[model samples]
Target: MSSSFRAPPIPSSDEIDLVALFQVIWKQKKLVLAATASAGLIAAIYAFLTPPQYEVSSVLRPAAINELDALNRSEIYTLPPGDALVRVGASLESYDTRLGFFRSNQKLFKAFEQPGRTLEQSFEEFNRNSIELILPDPKKANSLSAYIKLEMSYPKGVDGVAILNGFVDYAIATEREQIAADLDVIVKNRLNELKGKIDAARSNYEVDKEARIASLRETDSLRRAQLQDELKALRAQLKTGRIDRVAQLNEAIGIAKSLGIRKPSTPSALGESERNGSSSVMRTEINNQQIPLYFMGVEALEAERTVLMQRKSDDFTEGRIAQIAKELQLLQSNREIEVLNRRENEDLFLAGVQPVRAEEARLRNLSIDMSRLKLVTIDKQALEPLRPVKPQKALIILLGLILGGFVGAFIAVIRHLVKTRQSQPQSAALSMLSNSPTMVGSDTGLNKP
Candidate 1:
C-alpha cells in the first residue's frame, strides 16, 4: 500500500506575531519593577552610609641648593650632585624605610591612632593603603624635570594634610643624615690613606740617609789609612840610612878628583856628626889622609821628608779623598733639603686632614638635629581637601539603574518562555480531538460483523 506525507504549515505575514514579546513583558511588569526598585534602594543606602575618603598630595622638585653643593661650598669635601639627588629620592620613596620612620616617630601620627590598635598595626595599615610615591618617568630620570610626588589618603581632611607634611619633613631629615654619613666615610678614608703615604715617605728618607752616612764613613776611613801607610813607609826608608852610603861614595870621588886621582877608592873612615842622628854630615878619608867631606844624605833626607810632608798636605787639601768629602757633604745637604720639603708637605697634609675630620664630626653631630640641615624643599604643600573623593554617589546610582534594568528584562524573557511551553501541550491535544472522525458509524458496522 502507498503512503501519503504532508508538510507542516508555514505561517503567513499577518499570523507571524511580533507583539507576543511585548505581551510577555507586560505580564511580568510587576516583577521587573520590584527587582529594579530593590537594586536602586540598596545603591542609595550605600552611597549615604559609607564614610568618604580625602586625598592629600604634594610635589617635590630637587632643590637648587642641594646638600652636595652646600658641602662643596663649605670646602671640606666635594660630592657628586646627580648621584646624591637620586639617592635622596630613592631613600624617601623606600617603603620599609618610610614605615620605620613613622614607627619611630609615633607621636606625630598619634592623632590618627585608632583605639585598641597598636602603633605598629596602625602604621602597617596606613602604609599599605594610604601612602603613595609617584616617581619621575623612566626615560627622563636623569633630567632636571624629574620630580617626586607624594600622596596620602585619610578619612579626615585635616589628618591627610598633617600626615603628608610630617612625611615630607621626615624624608628630608633622613636624607640629610644619610648624606652626612657618606661624607664622613669618604673623608676619613682619604685622611687615613694620606697619613699612610706620609709615613712611608718619611721611613724611606730615613733609610736612605743612614745608608749614605755609612758609605761616606767607610770611604773616608779607607783613604786615611792609605795615606798613613805611605807616610810610615817613607819614615822607615829614612831610618835605614841607605842614603848615607851613596853620599859617602860621592865624597870619596870628589876628594880623589881634587887630588888629581883618576880612580877613586872606598873611604877608609867616615865620621858622623853628633848633632844629626843618622842624617848627619860625615867626613871621608882617602889614601890614608884625612879629607873633609860633606855627607849630603842628612840634608837630602831632610829635604825629601819636607817634600813628603808637602805632598801629604796637598793630598789632604786637593786629592780624591777631599773631593769625596765635599761631594758627600753636598749630597747630604741636598738630601736634607729634600727631607725637609717632604716633612713640610706632610705637615701641611696633616693640618688639612685635622680640619676635615673636625668638620666631618661637626656635620655628623648636626645631622642629629635635622633642623640644621634642609636637604629638600617641598615645592607644594598639601592643603585641606574641600570635598570627599570616594563613593562617587551619582555614578554609583546611575550604574545601579542600568544593571537593574538589564536583569529585569532577562527575568521577564524567562517567564514568558515557561508560560508558552505550558500552554502548547493543551492546544495540541484539543486540535487532534477535533480533527479525528466521529465514532457512531464505526460502532454500528462492527456490531453487524
Candidate 2:
C-alpha cells in the first residue's frame, strides 16, 4: 500500500477534438443530406447528357509456317513467321498507312463527318483518339501467338468494327505488296550483277584471245624471218660454191693446156711420164686429197665450168633449198588465229561464263505468286460492342455524393464557428455582471469579497 501510482499527465492541447467535430456534423445532418441529393441529381443529369463511346478491337497473330516457307526458301529473302507478324504489326502501327486507308475508304467514316469540321479534320481526330495499336508484353509468352492488337473507338452511331476489320486487311495487303516489290528489286539487281560479271568475263576472254593471237603472230613472223634468212644463206653458199668450182676448173684447164693434155688421163699415165723423164713416182700419193682438177682433160673441165655457170636456180640441186621452200609454204597461214577468228560464240571460251549465265538464269526465274502469301493471321476479329465504354453514370454519381458530403460538412463547421464567435461578447458581459463585487439595483445583491 506504501507504493503510490503516478497520476496521469494532462493531454496536450495539439490533440484533435474528434468528438466535438462529429457532434457538429450530426447537428448539420439535414444540410449534408440535401447537398448529397443535389450533387447526385446534377451528376445524373451530366451522365445522361454525355455522349457514349464504343470500342471494337481485333488481335493479330503470327502467320503459319507453310505460309512463310516460300519467302524463306534459298535464303534469298528470309522471313520467319514471327518476323512477318512483326512486319504486319509495324505496318498497322504506321500513322501514314492509317491515314491512307482513311482517305481511300472515306465512306466507312461518313458518320464522323459533321457540320463545322471538315472530313479530313474529323479523320485526323479519329486517327489520333480512335485508332490505337497495342503490342503484346515481351515479358510473357503468348501461346496464341498474339502479335499485336488494333483498337478503335467510335460514337454510338459509327461502325468501329467494320473500320477496324477493313484497316487490318488493308495493312496486310500493303505489306504483301511491299514484300513483292522488294523481292522484285533484289532479283533484278542480282541479275544485273550477274550480267555485269558475264560481260566482264567476255571482255577478259577477248583480251586474252587478242593477246594470244598477237603472240602467235609474233612467233610466226620470227619463224618466217629465220626461214627466209636460212634460205637466203643457203642460196648464197650454193652460188659461191659454183663460182669456186668454175675458178678451179679454169685453173686446171690452163694447167692441162700447158702440159699438152686434151683428154681425161689417170694418175698412172702421169706416173709413167714421171718415171721416164724424171724420177719414178707412185700412181697414188700418200694422202691424195682428191683427184687434181687438171687430171680431167681441158675439154671436160671447160664443159663442166659452162654447166655450173649456166645453172639458174640452186633449188634444183640443193636439197636443203627444197626443204626450206616447203617450210615457207607451210607457214603461210596461222591455223590457231584462223580458229580463233572463226569462233561464233566467244562466251563459251571465257572462264566462268557458264556458271555466271546459270546464276543469271536462276535470278531471272526466281519468282513466287504473292497472292497466296499470308502476312498475318487474324486471331481475333473485331466485333460489334453492345456496351458503351464511357459515360459511367453510377461511378459519377458515387463520386458526386462523396464530394458533396465533404463540402456540406465544411460549410456546417464554418457556420458553427461564426455563431460561436458572435455569442462570445454577450457571454463575457453576463459573467462580469454576475461575478462582480456588487450590482447596482439588481434583484439579488450577491457580491464576492
Candidate 3:
C-alpha cells in the first residue's frame, strides 16, 4: 500500500511574465516613489547651492601694416605685423605671464582666493582652468581666423570683463616692451662696436704719429751729421790752400831776390832798353814765351799771401757754405714733429673717416621712442556679462529627476524579484503535499480508527 506523488513542474528560467513583473512593481510603488522623491530633492538642493560662473571674452586682431611700419622700417630691428601679433599670442599663452599678472594685481583676483591654499596654488588653478585662448584651427581650410579670442570664466561676484581687458593691454604692452628692449640691445651692441673701431683707429693714428715724429728726428740727426762733416772738410781744404799759397809766395820772393828783379817783368819786357830817358823796345818779334810767377815783384806776392793768411773763416769765400748753414739750421727744429705733438684733435687727421662718420651718424639718429609702437589691437573688448554661464538650475533639476526615476525603478524590480523567489519553494512544497496518496490514506486510516 505505497503511494507515489510528484510536484507540479516549475516554470523555465527563460520564461518572463510581464504582467506579473508589473504587478510586483505596482505593489512596491510607494517605496519607489519615495526613493525618486529623495533623489530629486537632493539634486535640487545641490543645484541651488552651486555658485554661478560668468564668462567674459575678447577678440584680438592683427595690427595694420601702417601700425608696424615703424618697426619694419627701423634699421635696428625689422618685425612684420604677423610676427608682432604672433608674439602677443605667445605672451598670452605663457604661464609665467599669467602668474605675473595675477601676482601684480592681487586685488583683481581676490575672489579666486580659497582658504588653506596659497596664492600661487590658487593662481595655478586659475591659470589652468579659468583662462582660454581660442586660435584658428590649422587643420581646417576655412578656419583661418584673422583674430584670436580670449575668454575667461569667473565665479559670481568677480569682474571678469575688466580683468580680461587689462590683461589684453598688459600682454600687448609687455610684448612691446620686450621688442623695445631687443632693439635697444641691438643698438647698444652696434654702438659699442663702432666705438671700439673708433678707439682702434685713434690708437693706430697715435702710433703712426709717433713713428712719423721719430722718422723726422732721425732724418734731422742724419742731415745735421752730414752738414757738420761737409763743414769740417771745407775748413780743412781752406787751411791747406792758405798754407800752400804762402809757401809758393815765399819761394817766389826768394827767386825774385836771386834774380835781382824788384818789380814785375815779362821776357819781352827785359828786351826793352831806355835810350836818353826814353824807353825803346829792342824785342819786337812775336814769340810764345810764358811769364814766371817770380817775375812779379816780391812786394805784390807778399801782400797777397798776407791777405790769405789773415782770412779767419773760409765760409765767406764759398757761397755753398751759407746755403749749407741755412739747411742745417732748418733741420735743427723738426716743424712737422712739433705740429704733430701740438695737435689736440687727432680724429680729424685719421684716414678713411668719411664712411665711418656717416654710419655712426645714421645709427645715432636711429634712436626713437618704442612705447608708441603697437604690436596688436584689441578689436572687441570684453563686456560685463549679465547672465551667468554656468549652474543651470532647470537642467540640473530635470537630470536629477530622470536619474532618480531610474534608480527607483531598479529598486522596485529587485524587491519584486526577491519576493517572487522566496514564495516559489513554498508553493512547490504545498503542491507535493496535496498531491501525495500516502497522506490521503493516512487521513482515511485515522478516521477509521
CA shift of 383, model 2, Å: 2.1
Model 3 residue 119 CA deviation in Å? 4.9
Q: How much lDDT does each candidate structure score?
A: 0.63, 0.84, 0.83
lDDT of 2 at 240: 90
Q: Which has the greatest lDDT? A: 2
lDDT of 2 by residue, 178-208 (tens): 9999998888788888888988988899899
Runs in model 2 lying further than 4 Å from the true structure: 1-30, 64-66, 80-86, 116-120, 136-146, 273-289, 404-449
Regions more than 4 Å wrong, model 3? 1-37, 59-65, 78-86, 93-96, 114-125, 132-149, 267-292, 342-344, 438-449
Residue by residue across 1-449, what tens digits does model 1's lDDT show?
22122334655757636587677767788878777887787887888788888888998765555544556664555545544456667876777677877877677676567999887788778788888888877876575665678888877434677678877777776777776777677656765765666566557656765676666656666665665565555545553444454455456445545544442222332223223424533445546655343333334434544554444233343355455455545543455444544564443433334655555456454333324654555678999887888887988777777777667877998988787679877877776566444444455566785
Worst 10 residues of 1 by lDDT: 264-273
True lDDT of residue 232, candidate 3: 85
The stretch of ten residues in a row with the least summed lDDT in candidate 2 is: 1-10
lDDT of 3 by residue, 135-178 (tens): 87877778454678999999988889889998888888888888
Q: Between candidates 1 and 3, name the one with more favorable TM-score.
A: 3
Residue 169, candidate 1: Cα error in Å is 2.9
Error of 1 at 320 (Å): 16
Order the candidates by lDDT, highest first: 2, 3, 1
